[model samples]
Target: MMLVLLLLIYTSQHALAVVVEMNAGEMSVLLPCQFSGFIPDDPTVMWTRNDLVPKSVHVQHKEGDDFQGQNQRYRGRTKMRPDALDTSDFSLTLRKPEMTDSGNYTCSISGGRGERTLEDVELQIKDQQVEVKVVEGSDSVILPCKTKHDLPEDTRVEWTRSNPELMLVHIYPHKSDQRKKQDGLYRDRTAVNKDLLRTGDLSLTLKHPTERDSGGYICTIYRDKDILRQKVVLQVKGWFPPWATALLVLLVLFVVSGGLLFHFRHYFMSVYKVEVDSGVESVLLPCKTVAHLPEDVKVEWMDSDDKKVHVYQSSSDHSDEKHQVYRNRTEMKRNLLRTGDLSLTLKHPTNEDNSTYTCTVYNREGNILLKKDVLLAVRVPQVEVDSGVESVQLPLKTTLHLPEDAKIEWKDSDDDHLHVYEKRFDQLEQQDQVYKDRTKMNEDLLRTGDLSLTLKHPTDGDNRTYTCTVYSKEGNILLRKKLELKVKGRVQVQDQTGDIRNRSSSIDPTPLMADQSV
Candidate 1:
């Protein structure tokens, strides 16, 4: 009985000291040991990294039993999977492995059976660097799957194009570091799709593109553990076709042909007709030349006598000798090519100044255009007056004067209304009205320009104003003068003394008789 008990204890001790050989990359390798030898119920399981020693052990207590492990990098990341705990599995699961986590790990537990240790668990961690591919101009590009694993936060991504003509447009952390060439045509027209930075999408787009942009491109991912590369072929198609090119050429030809036709019509075929107002103080003679003509073209103006009246050369400074009667008054309306305001101004016009004028434009290529026979007319009007306030009484008549062609008419001051004079020239002569007998004029003095209308019996009522108006042949009222009628002296008075003495004598006869008796 003693030998059987001893043999059972030795088998349990050998089983408790079993090796926990963990082959690298296994899902969850069991640390070839169990807690059944200790307490069949709850027992502590512990693990530790040899690199971290005792200081980095993770400890867990179940009732009075304790388990511990020293793995600072894997501190809370290790746990006994709940499903495996019921089967005496004392194995720990690493949530995610990193390159820095490769080392030896051990599991130890102290309980009712005895203190047991599982040694030399070679935890070999490897980084499966994933393959990423970037297909240029494809639907999309994918980043390497290695980025999905646990990696250092400071890891960087680099994108490069394998083709010499193609280049990296932009990258994160730096915009200026993006590959660019001074002589490249797309120098400023490329940009990256920055919205997908989180998911590791590094894509770029070109603006106003051409087919030459199609080429191979590369995207390289740089991590602390490894580096990754991807290649993509970009395919491009022409935006414009052969038909579009032909249409563009035709459009340019049509524009040039139309411009030439317009130039021919303006320079060789167009005509301008000019008319000037008669009797004006001066006349403006307008002349227009083709806008395409050079600024150095010379314009000459000539009168009917073939005398050069004015000369305008754009290259020469302004001179009075080259100007017509009105110096500095003649001006082009606007810049030569803008508006043909070659309208000239004349000053102090007269009848002799009326004639046909000619405008000739000459360039270095000889006479280019001409405008002929523009007529200008000047007019004058004669002055005459048809009215009569010919004369007044002695004192008033002395202050009056008249012109040679004056006519006379008479009317009473009270009857003088504007409409009263609207009678026929002959009817005025046949009238024997109140003014007929009262007024007269000296017929012989009229030839000497003396229009004196004498009033026979002038009275105070005649003290009013009379107008003498002179008119031009054009019916223009040229001159007007007003005459005032005046009367001099006072009136005589008669006495009523005798009748007043008689009335007083009859009313007071008693006082008179008393005075007589005394």
Candidate 2:
């Protein structure tokens, strides 16, 4: 229940509206209220919120500030100006403000018979953070920022970069925006829609983001005395930086000058170009080293920024200080580490992960041993399947030959087996109840890696994730692929979450196949 109580206090009186803005979880607040003119001896001042009972927030009496009759909730959390005659200052102070503390506050003063209201203040808190990602040297990057509350046309919006360098990125004050106060690097490379400000849009359009342009940006909005704030962190990936390219060219020259002596050694360095569909559920960034590692070897994997993505040592994973967003979603095959395979599996990757990942292998003595650079290229799949009643064959055929003793497992969104082929036989009894008899797989073609599954009748519930896991004779995970299953057999309908969909599709009798590009 909301507490709001007002008993006909307005009698042809104009109350001045003042807005005091701040984010939630603040330590304290000062509500401004003052009156000009003469005072009668020791004046009686009272600060109150109509919604709060007893109507007493703070009182200034001749005995020097009292709160004996004030509401207990705000008894010791409020303050007001003591000198009302000479300074004519009257403002309420609140401590430990929260989201629920946002509302209307009234300051009424009564002394020597006459009573009048001083000011009506409205305090607000803005709480939201936006993220933006861009490819280095891309055409432009747009940062979306909008406040739940509306802003006046003359509201001021200022953009500033808080990381790498503290500088003014852009500004719009006195009803118009200009680059005069903006940093020289961003003067001609930025623009914002002025008309959009009328609808609470403080979005900024940054043109042509370079390598140095990646960092945190702050957007401060001001209207009259009210203030709102937003923060955006932009990540720039891709593009060969000029410095790194030059160093690479120098390395080539150094190798050529030495009569191509290290040419043969280059063959030993492993490089993997892993590519996957943009919307895949997961992807593997392959990393391996032929050099034998000591038991206490420290392994580190990092992004282009040299930020630690994963770390391992002493036959265990140490993930401390890992980036907050990528903390728990990263893992490695600990069972295969002793054999020199240091592949990192990233779960639920987005476009931001479409960058270079450097795998650094270190010896027990902290000496650099081997470095493998894995370039991850993410793009939409080439084939597009339309959802309809027609049978859709999900094309998944591999060139690798499967041995007779190979193992394969097909799973749905729930990680339950939809189909399983192991020991040269089809095990339908091991499948989940939802796909008991509806799944079909050709066991005779198992030797040709034709482990595909076809659904007898696809339905709306089939629109979900499906994965295929293959293992070698040694029980090692040979390959894994995840695909999205959709259905369009029924009419378009909206679900309880307000999402409308027409889902239906058929898989080509083949089980899930590994993502093609990688």
Give me candidate 1's TM-score against the actual structure: 0.22
Span of ten consecutive residues with least summed lDDT in model 1: 417-426
RMSD of each: 36.1, 25.5
Q: Write the per-residue lDDT of candidate 2 for residues 467-496, one digit (tens) a residue.
A: 676777886555555566656443444577
lDDT of 1 by residue, 376-479 (tens): 65543222221233334421132234444443343333435211111112124444454555554444543353434556555444555544333333433333
TM-score of 2: 0.35
Off by over 4 Å in 2: 1-22, 25-46, 53-96, 112-114, 135-140, 147-154, 159-169, 174-190, 196-200, 207-518
lDDT of 2 at 343: 90
Could you tally the backbone clashes for each prediction? 15, 14
Q: lDDT of candidate 1?
A: 0.46
